[model samples]
Target: MDAYWSPLCTACEGLESGSVLVTPVSERPFEIEATRDDRIVVKFRDSGEERPLHREQFSVLVDRLEGSPITLETLAPGVEPYAAVLSLGPEFVSDGEALSLALDEAVGGESPHLLTPEEARTRPERVHDDAVLLADLLDRVDADDPSSLDTGTLTDLYVLLSDVQRGADRVRGTARNSLLERLGPDQQLHGRFGTVRRTTRERRYSKDDEIIFDALDEHDVPREWVLGVDPEKLDVVLAVTDLDEDDVYDVDEQVYVQKTGVDEGEKFSRLQGLAERLEEVEGGEAIQEDLLEIERRIDEALASG
Candidate 1:
């Protein structure tokens, strides 16, 4: 039987927005049959087994369309009049004409408009939806005061968080366009651009609470663990943890050890000495047996010492 389509599938309304696209997970091919209320009905192509999943739950099955892959180098105002500049790959350099054309295509207007920190701060309306606000709310939630919000406020908080994120994305796209105009003709940009993972889901992060967001990690830290943090501090903490947006992890409260290849204590230094000795040996041929012995000792130290 053909999967029925329902006009009432409000859950799939984003299908019309072009922001969300659904595709089967590589392992299982599923056809989206219909959406109703907050649920999406999907039928597995192979098994013909149909199921209804909450829209929020089903969203993880698909991907959202983010903007262009072009990277932008964020610059300090002292270094450049613009907030950022186009960062083409090391091998590719854009001529002035190419940069101008790309900039025109990106913003459809004059050269990039740079925002000074003072200007940016004065015009709060421009960057209205910011992560700073979300961080503030989490702070309040952690305080456990009588005026603390009810449990239902979390939904509202998430909605606002999404709005802020979308606003930031729109701003970033414009910044990228502006930065493209700043690139000098044939200017080379070295270093690989970092990638960020974005998602519709939000997870709580706390610095004082000792939570680190890692890929493939999940945590169920209690609400009490949510810590208050200023935006700058939060940025620093995230940089240290290296957790970007869109990381989803299972919520586990247990601590686990991460292994580094080097052995602990004096053995690692001794291994270095052994390596230097091998390098000094004639073609490193005579010390091959000695090197092997040292490596064996280092491995034993790493494993048991």
Candidate 2:
């Protein structure tokens, strides 16, 4: 039976010259030869120790040359003696375009070389869906009057909103890092939070709270109502009075503020809501079906093992 060989095949690595490499096309093993010429001649190794393969039994290995730094001179010669050079056809050229074409064929095509837009789209579906939903929920909160929302509703919203924001941060961080690694540092940065800071009264309150208080007081009543912040695009500012001190804060009554822009906060909130909905949906029968299928596959694999 003819053997198959692929450079990328794990079995092909570290193969010595003159070693028999199988071609999947012909299912016959050919003796490898390293040549000083531009081409390496693949032939049947007829050592008395092993059965001598007939001429019809072996197929020639032809590689088109390109401008690749690799040349036949660099190939290590195998154990086979020089045989009459068999002319297959016109000489293969190593021009840039031809070389590229050869490489493309050797690797089985350029399709795997680059991702289609559809594949790229699938890559971000989970993250993008979460972002959109969070952005929508945030917009709803921004439009509503904080005073109109009751404490229970506010707490629930805050909890949901916070969860979404954190989730978004996690996804964005992972996706951004992945892109950066693949595309290099020159590409645009991908995450919502450009910078993050831990909120501390001591750090933000300045030497004189009176001076900072006065500055804030100059703003309108609604603006003055803002208390606490966590920085960046999320810029979470809350109507300090709306929070139930006992429920929202710890025993110390210390609540960390997220400083994010109003627009960004709105966007984040919508995305958060969407993510929550997706999780809820995923908890249903559809996801269970997927789990069942996975279980079935695992069971089948175990049985085979």
RMSD of each: 30.7, 23.6
Q: How much lDDT does candidate 2 score?
A: 0.37
The per-candidate count of clashes, in order, stands at 7, 32
lDDT tens string, model 2, 1-305? 02212222222223333234332222234443433223344454333233332333213333222233223223324311111121111122222112122333333322111222222232234344433443444445642676777775565456545544555466556754665556633444433424222222454445465666777777634434655544332223324345354554445556785634234445444544554665788465654455445434432332233
Computed on alpha carbons, the lDDT of every model, listed in order, comes to 0.37, 0.37
**Which sections of candidate 1 miss by over 4 Å?**
1-126, 129-132, 142-150, 184-305
- TM-score of each model, in listed order: 0.19, 0.21
> What is candidate 1's local distance difference test score?
0.37
